[model samples]
Target: MTMQNPVRPLLTPLLAALVLAGCATAPPSLDKALPQTPAAFSEGGVPWTTAAPAEAQARGEWWKAFGDAQLDALVERAERGSTSIQVAAARLAQARAVLGATDANRALQVGLGAGASREAQRGLGVAPNTVLSAGAQLSYELDLFGRLAKASDAAALDVRSREALLRSTRLLVQAQIAQSYFALRALDAEQTLVHGTVEAYRDTLRLTERRYAAGDVAELDLVRVRSEVAATESEALALERQRAQLEHAIALLAGEPASGFRIAADDWRATPPQVPAGVPSTVLARRPDVSAAQSALLAAQARVGVAQAAWFPNLALTASGGFASSELSELFRSSARAWGIGALLSLPLLDGGRREAGVANARAELDAALAGYREQVLVAFKDVEDELAALRLLARQGDAQGQAVDAAARATTLSETRYRNGLVSQLELLDARRSELRNRREALQVRSAQYQSTVRLIRALGGGWGEAA
Candidate 1:
């Protein structure tokens, strides 16, 4: 036992080094923190058998599917100049810089310094002399406890999260622009409908006044006709105001001032693109926001590992070599060389619970990140389901609206024919015309809705399975 004591002392340090190095354990996998995803969406009218293929991905330029060259140009312009996208890009750059800094922490730190100082002796009765020195130093943290590596991994994940967020920002902006553009066109169609009615009312008003002056129709009939014309004009005026506001909004989204931007009265011809209904499981992998949330969770877990490492002892190897002398001429001479090679080991014997607080804080962050990630998943599924329901319901509603438009048109034609022959009262003719106008406007509105819902569904699918993001 006496002979064994000496060898045991030598082996103790080696074993401790191995243990400390082993403390650099990897963070847990994301599956443990993620909530379970549904096998399929609850929304009706989708192809359940179409499991999203592994090769399917989002096309970044989803707006191009609308077949509108103007919209495509606007989206491209916004991609380059939008302030919101610029802000996201700037944040991504910042995250990249932080990652670079963290990675640099793993390398040796070196500095070269030179200084001269004059010293004076008062009571010792000694001569004063200037001290001159020049040297180089280097320090490297050996990552014995894995703190540096953990921190670096966390920073790298942060960069990934920021990058994903950038993509999310672009997707959102493109969707908004499409919705706004379609709405503007719908308004134009409504304006044309209203304007045509105004002209028809003007003709009817002239005929009623002629009848009133000749005593063939009552004065009350003339007043009623005039009132109807005024009300129709008022409706047209309101629609014009709405169109102006919508136009301004589109201009802003296109990254241009309202005063400088204009979209002429082009016919609303953009049709909704047919997007493939992929599997719900594939959607989780496709959404940029969901990816960002997952990355954030990973980064938090890495930070937690770093905090836990604080409890273990730290070890670092250091080496410094330089030449120094009291006289300037001899400062760099070989005879004046000074050198040191050593190792430092630090253990937190007592820290008033500061280290404990750090560990607890890191754990709390991990919990928050986990919750956020699961929430993102839930929201993503909800968005897809909501869009599916809209598309299904809107398709049926548009069909019924088309039938209503046809019926109203027939009624208006028959009523006009009877009024010219004096077979029906003026009020009956007016009622038929009003019904036609309202139904025609409603049909236009439904068409606009179909286009809007289609765009919304595409966005909810995390940019769809066809396009390259």
Candidate 2:
């Protein structure tokens, strides 16, 4: 009578188990783990039409909007050379490699092995026998509980997070370069104004000295005029020092040595561009930080699924085919060949709560990731509001400052005429000149602030500005 194979009886039951496990659903996505987005920003005025997701869009040369060729060049150089960007890119590559490794777990693994051995029974005084073996072994773990799939998903999300971080780093470097360049230019303008004032003061001091020598003015008046010239000259020197410091900062941002880099003195002429703050929801898409945080949260969620899957049984299939012979010449002969195949299903009965602790840890990580994502979203909103308010208030301040500068200039001109005609004291003329200088410097400061705010806003909005198509 023919006997049935013993392992064949278990195949039907194992196949049924596999089918049941196949119906198991994957972990739910955490995409909605956020508060409701406001329709309009508190400081951004009314919301305009919502734009398509800007994260997927290329952030074309937003610096070009300022119409400054120098700024464009500096930002481009910084993007290419910034070390922060390089670090983030390296992290992205690592995450991608991890993903490739995680995916490899789902594919069959094959390995070739060879061995030789000699055996002897010492106590029996038997002769030694030589053995030689060569084989290829294969193994594949069936994803019966979705553990491998969830791990792969987590790895992929990690790659996405790293990619977003790289983009964020690039945007930050670009913005820093632009802001520093503009600040250096503003200082140049201020230094020029101070130097011109110093020259004017020097001329006045010469006139005062001549008048004192002719006995037409007191020695006290001449002494005061000389002191004013010295003070104004000192102020010009201080401004020069500040401009040098700013130039050094710009060089560092551009990835160049401060000792060798130089920016020639130029007029502050780059106009701050008007960046439109579209509907508040668009910030979620545009901001790379926000995107990175969201990806982290999803990855953490997938890890939780992976941890939970640990409670289920693991299934693996292994196979090996080989040639073995005592003599090397007969190793590959048909009679020396061997082959084996196996399927293993294992479930741990006890592990001192290790699996439970793993689940707990993964869940806690998920909670932390969720909290981080929410905080990032809130901070992004706050950043947009802060820059919008700064731009608005600075514009008004600039207008008022312009009027003050105009009035101060008129006062200085009148004071000069009165002093020359001996109708006003030398002290009054000096006060008017100081006021004019202060107003001009303040105006330049307001302009600088506007430019810096524009760059910051672009960064907050993920480094670009344009109407949505």
Which stretches in model 2 have alpha-carbon errors above 4 Å?
1-33, 48-52, 277-281, 467-469
TM-score of each: 0.90, 0.92
Compose the digit string of candidate 1's lDDT tens values, residues 1-469. Answer: 3455677865565666568557656555667666665555677544333234322244557787789987888788778777788899999999999999999989998988877888888999878987777778888888866789999999999998998888888888888888888898899999899999999999999999888899999999899989989999999999989988988887776678889777888877777886554533356666788888888998999998888888676777788788777887888889888898888877765799997799889989988999999999788778878777887888899899989999999998999899878999999999999999999998998889888888877776667556422
TM-score of candidate 1 on Cα atoms, chains taken together: 0.90
Candidate 1 lDDT (Cα, whole model)?
0.81
Go through the candidates in order and give the clash count of each.
3, 0
Best by TM-score: 2
User: Cα deviation of 180 in candidate 2 (Å)?
Assistant: 0.5
CA RMSD per model (angstroms): 3.5, 3.9
List the lowest-lDDT window of 10 residues for candidate 1.
47-56
Best candidate, lDDT-wise? 2
